[model samples]
Target: MTETLRPPASVRLVRIGEEHAGQRIDNFLLTQLKGVPKSHIYRILRTGQVRLNGGRIDAARRIASGDLVRIPPLQVAARTDEPPSGAVDAFAERLTPRILIDDSELLVINKPAGIAVHGGSGLVLGIIEGVRKLRPEARYLELVHRLDRDTSGCLVIAKKRSALRSLHEQFRENAVKKVYTALVTGAWNQKMRTVDAALDKNVLQGGERMVKASAAGKAAATTFRRLRAFQTATLVAAEPHTGRTHQIRVHAQFMGHPIAGDERYGLSERNRAFRQQGLRRLFLHASRLTFVHPGSGRTLTVEAPLDAELQSFLERCP
Candidate 1:
């Protein structure tokens, strides 16, 4: 079945609600105008086609409750059924069983590898979309943080705006404690406790994002503890002091031991050898997270155990 979008015929003023008050205007417009191209959304904002409270507004402006947003008419092409109905339902079903915690303000899940946290970069459906489908009545659902698509483990989602803000603040202040489990290509040095390297992220001509340890990059650090060492591989626990994109993977690479099965940064020969031995995905997992509960004001800790594949592979490592 093909998906069709019917753009509104005329300009309209929409009153912002408390649930969406602090959201960026660009994000608000994306939610308001479904099926519209992302570039078009930014274009409209750049040209002042959208407004807040009868005044032109930029995309980064935070909207407030009771603010009136003017959305201009648009023409969008029909979107084909990229993700079939069966696929969407299958994703939702796969995510439902992985849910670890669900409360009035938060939803935590042991996110499975290979599924993105939210739809983007040519993906039509992701974890957030699947969760919305699971709970149709949920008024607000947003990702508090993100995990790489190939990295499985604990993920937190906010069910309310206030909760989202609080969690964001926690992350910004580096108050959230995150722990990851990883298997690297070589035995880790027990004496090396930390990798305090700065990382610079850049996108290549083909749009592939890459991160490297650079002196001019933002400060990043990760503390590592050797868990168990095999002949050629080592399992370790990593605690990141700063949240940078692919910090652990890059730091591991800088230590001459890229993560096993990390296609972008690991040794190709090592990865191929591991693949033959049944390790198919990146050997990185968000094993645990600790933070203050937004609503209860109590310390909360969540842990996701290694999946069967990872655990079995570790058993086979020698």
Candidate 2:
């Protein structure tokens, strides 16, 4: 339930470093506040609750190192103790059999390709909720990074917010290594190739997400190495350099090898062919991720193998 009256959350200013001095207000807020809902900040900006130099300023205004900002008070909701939904319970049950690795600071899993990382739409709760219920003493676990709802593979979860922050920094700086495996349509003659494409987003009527090639979009680049070529499909190992939304999937489509069973940006004929071969979900999985540990500063690497369906599909592919 929404709080009828919100008291106030204090705002403070920390001088930006030389590198971030001219960042926009919204960007600065996102960096500092971390978890505040975007809509709430946009509303605050619209009402002129955020100020610069003792006067209201646009949310897009670039903030420099010495600039002062005043933020009005707000009623922040208390954290609730509601139990997660029944689906989360089911998802938790599934996760119990699928956990690949775990540690004091993290939970690593090979998420099946079809299941979402978390809940939405009609979903009551996500993996985190299920994980929490399963390991109740694991009070502070959080996702270090997100894999797509339909894409499967190794997913990282931080045990605490500090660890989460450190990991987020690592991702932001592109210091982590991520590798995805997929069955793409067509026989790729290129043993190795790099595809660079920009992504532009379009939101559907029911909030279905789509992306396209556009100059106005972020620079997305991915490198692919063909591991094995089937008669009609190729299994490729993909390494994305810049983590734009749907970068790997879009780049694969650009190569005319839309991942088999991928609904978005995939050819229906290829999808049908994949289904004929007994694939149910998109033929993609995050197989591995390597990074320096947030707490120990040691290099930490994790891998999730293809589930039974993918393993069987590869075996049958001629």
- The lDDT per prediction is 0.86, 0.74
TM-score of 2: 0.75
Q: Highest lDDT, which number?
A: 1
Return the top candidate by TM-score: 1
lDDT tens readout by residue for model 1, 97-129: 889889999999999999887665466877889
C-alpha TM-scores of all predictions: 0.82, 0.75
Badly placed stretches (over 4 Å) of model 1 are 1-77
* RMSD, candidate 1, Å: 5.4
Look at candidate 2 and give me any clashing residue pairs.
6-75, 8-74
